[model samples]
Target: MSKPVIDIAIGLLLHHGKVLVGWREAKQHQGNKYEFPGGKVESGESPEDACRREIYEEVGIGIKQWYAFDRIQHEYEDIIVYLHLFYAYVPDDLLTLIQQPWTWYHRDQLMQLNFPKANDTILQRLFWSHFIKIGDKLSEFQPHADSLFYWRVDAEQFQRDVLHTYSADDLTKLILNDEHYQQLSDDLKPLIKTLHLKQHQLMQFKKGDLELGKRYIAACHDLVALQHAEQIGCEAVFVSPIQPTQTHPHTKALGWTQLEEWSKQSQVLVFALGGLHPNDLAQAQLHGAYGIAGIRNF
Candidate 1:
């Protein structure tokens, strides 16, 4: 039998002035060098647990707000290794007491450091810290023009036979957990076509439960919604009722005044998602959005 394979979990730690990296002294045929902080994952231990243990043992600090980021597999030489990379933001103060011989490179200081295959891309994305919800297959993170471009679709568009579906964060988790839709939300699936995303979503003015995040779409403010989108790493947020219509005609409309206001001071991308269409895009852009997004046009 091929020798029993070992799994590895890595923590990509970011602090005020440095990122957590570790040196590989373990004996393996593969070249040993500095790498992200991690150790071989025990069969029974969860990835998160492994990461925490490795960090605490190697550096003597705690990780907070840990979240699953990516799972990558690679063949360095003859052996196949699986890497589960987790993201945890660290406070700026922890950079002082680190024990290991770790290098503290400024964000783009990769030239002198050694990075594994998937580490570069992951690191770049994490640094930008902004991602747009494209259709189900992909989500654009980097900017297209003056603004970050994102393709968004509502829950109504998800079940349709369309090629791409955009979703919020929660809806994405649901799609991933589904046996059938597990691969449905694959971010790299649509590389050949375009960037897409599937977000479960939260709102204060869209048509869902107010307790969560959905609002009636009419009650939301343009600036507040834009900030929420940026905070969640979304490239753009949709603001509706620009023209006023039946779906939510009763809800107050922000009208041109709000649109003009958004154009002046908002930091995130805004899509006119209310009773609007392709022709109306010019109006939205004129007010200050990169472009207009709407279900009616599609």
Candidate 2:
């Protein structure tokens, strides 16, 4: 005999920059864990319908807009769970009507909470999505303070000079090239925030090989590459040559207008690359970029 498989639907309610989550009662399964508010799907209930019903029961609010986000299957000691996750948006007025004790958590703050093991995949997705939204707020982003520094230096330089420049807190996320990543010691690997992969490298990489806390960003020149990056589970995409640069002065640039158009169609967060400067942050946001990425100017 096989253990019963329970189908569950959950809602990730977003408002402003925070997400609403509720604490499970100590008596319930996965007790005391912080989770997106939801419940089991009744027989014949559609996942979307179940999500809406559960959200209303748990939070006392009806979701106005929602779409499927991700799905997960996990087997515990006694039961199997098929979790359906959805991203939802609710009106501000409904927030106060929630019956359960709930809290709004910022993306960074969520890292501290202890959620059920099965929720790890969704948690990572949420964190990346939140960070991408934050990247869009260019006026509030401080490169030295908030932005991850992309280090493209040689391994020898990294160990000698670059490593000593800042503490772990000052540079939490460091992006490294594939060669540099391979050269890193096991101890240094954990310190990296993301892996910067070229188009070919990204195509060759496997999603399962990705580390839990680290993110992957790939350089994409066109829509096909962007779609490929998203399919490969890349956290972000860099749409490059937005402006002609000294490195490739002859290459055509995708001006702000086209950049905006492309970004609107992109599935993943799009970063404007090529000939970008620190001052271009605002302009990048206007053109629908998550942020600006550059080799020399940044």
Candidate 3:
């Protein structure tokens, strides 16, 4: 009738390379389909409260804590459904897929899934890429160039808003505080293993001012640093403003062609800045950028 919209809670139950997906009774209209483990929100509940309730009812276990994720607003039929979604990281053994309505699929086995929306990129990104992994033991986080969460804060003040909140006792933070590296709030320092230096902070004393709520990626523009990254032992650099940015409208960006050329000579990892988003990571990689770093996306 009314584009049957429902509040759903999905669980990512992974075990032996398989993830659990659930559906309703095999032949109903919205049935016989696989989705995350969740259901509708009761009349008096908040989405978070509803998500917890729905997961326990459908999967018969509790989610110790869930990360706040996307708010998907989509059109399911003649009407629009604003689905406030979250991700719950549960153990692999917590799942029991003997229920006729449930099945488990691995990352490589997506072709075998029957969910109508699984084909949409949203599902892949939501379940696979977006969730920041937590609760892993120290032995699990093998430090490599791969798992680093790189970000660029607009000098000293910006760090207060973006980097301050995600603190847990264990996460190690590496920041290029530019000129103000010494100015970081003392309370924030004990929580992290801090490394502050001049070369990484090139953008710190740049010509223009930063915009509120808009943070772009950029190469720190220290040719000296580029020559000495190996000697200095640094991993990445931000080269930016390939397009006109509000913060540095006059600072002509070293466009993609130049970035490619520069990248070949520099041993340090490179990222394209200016105006960027999470989706830009792929484009960045193609152009010799190891990853994209920006405050706007984080």
Candidate 1 ranges with C-alpha deviation above 4 Å: 1-4, 16-18, 25-29, 118-121, 127-148, 151-200, 203-298
In the range 1-298, model 3's lDDT, one tens digit per residue, is 5676665544444343345677656675456666766666778888878877776777677766554444565675454555655544445456553344566665445545666553243344322221111111222332332333333334433434334645543334233333433455767644433233344443243322322111222345545555453223333455665555667778876676776776666544565666666677777667766555544343
TM-score of each: 0.47, 0.57, 0.39
Give the TM-score (vs. native) of candidate 2. 0.57
Which candidate leads in lDDT? 2
Sort by TM-score, best first. Answer: 2, 1, 3
Q: Model 1, range 53-152, lDDT digits (tens) per residue?
A: 8877877777755645567677654567777777565655665767758766544455356666646545544332112222333233323322223333
Task: Give the root-mean-square deviation of each candidate in angstroms.
Answer: 10.3, 8.9, 17.1
Q: How many residue pairs clash in each candidate at the backbone level?
A: 25, 0, 10
lDDT of 2 by residue, 1-298 (tens): 8999999999888664468888987999989889888889999999889999998888888874565666789999889999987766555678788775888887667777989989987775556421221222223324355455565555455452344454654434455666667776676665556677788877776645555445678888877777677665566778888988997999999889988887766545678888878688889878887677766564
Better of 1 and 2 by TM-score: 2
Off by over 4 Å in 2: 1-144, 154-166
Give the lDDT of residue 181 in candidate 3.
35
Clashing pairs in 2: none
